[model samples]
Target: MKKSPIETVLGILVILVAVSFVHYAATKIDVRPQDGYTVSAVFLKSGGLESGADVRISGIKVGSVTGLKLTDDYAADITMTIRDNVKLPKDTTASVASDGLMGGKFLLLEPGRAKEKLNDGDKITKTKDFKSLEDMIGDVIFLATDSGDK
Candidate 1:
């Protein structure tokens, strides 16, 4: 069978479009951590958190989640890279949070006013555990049913 010139042109056009789309997608996903220092925090629940998630402070992204692991005590050990200029205090707290009910997860930082500063590799001691919607519903149901138990 002999192929037409138009068919050959269409095939090359499709390949070019696919390559361009792949390059666009690759550029949009900026997951590589910027130049920064790393610190860790332990959370009882990861709450669907994933690596490359944004780390935000007061609604502004200042870092990113670099690693996630399971600790010896069965907790979620999260490592994050924070911007060099954003120095956190020893009393700063980290929490796994979501943007909204239908949105993705992020690590929220609440910096505390301490004279001392946290150094690289220091583990944050204060952290708020992630609470899922099911947990909140269970708590409500328990209170509603246990009102007369005691």
Candidate 2:
């Protein structure tokens, strides 16, 4: 027996919807890179930090931010997954920096000279937030006037 045309179209629609759902689920899941370890940092201000933001070392992409949260002390907590082979020293600093005047934000890692290496769950102590252009201009103007008075 041959199936009706309407029934055949309905079956196709159902299959298409199922496939679309699977695709959506796959994309929503966070698939971390294989050779990486997760680390976190607390910042006073994240300043446009979002999940999937690039984490860089010496202007080179090393990892991406995976998560962000607010701590009890009212600070922003950012979680990043860095490659395992890229060992960071104990005194390393993690700061929030921007790419350029109109570019996106990223995490900058500055390695220190400490002998010990950072382990998982270690928090980077030194952090710098994005400074607004207006603030910088204001500071420059203030400095110029103040220096002239002196």
Each model's C-alpha lDDT? 0.93, 0.86
Q: Each candidate: how many clashes? A: 0, 0
Alpha-carbon deviation at 139 in model 2, angstroms: 1.6
lDDT of 2 at 60: 84
User: What would the TM-score be for candidate 2 when compared with the true structure?
Assistant: 0.73
lDDT of 2 by residue, 1-111 (tens): 989999999999999999999999999764656358888889987887898998899998778898999999989999998888898888888888887889998999999
Model 1 is weakest, by summed lDDT over 10 consecutive residues, at: 28-37
TM-score for each candidate, following the candidate numbering = 0.78, 0.73
In candidate 1, list every pair of residues with a backbone clash. none
lDDT of 2 at 34: 38
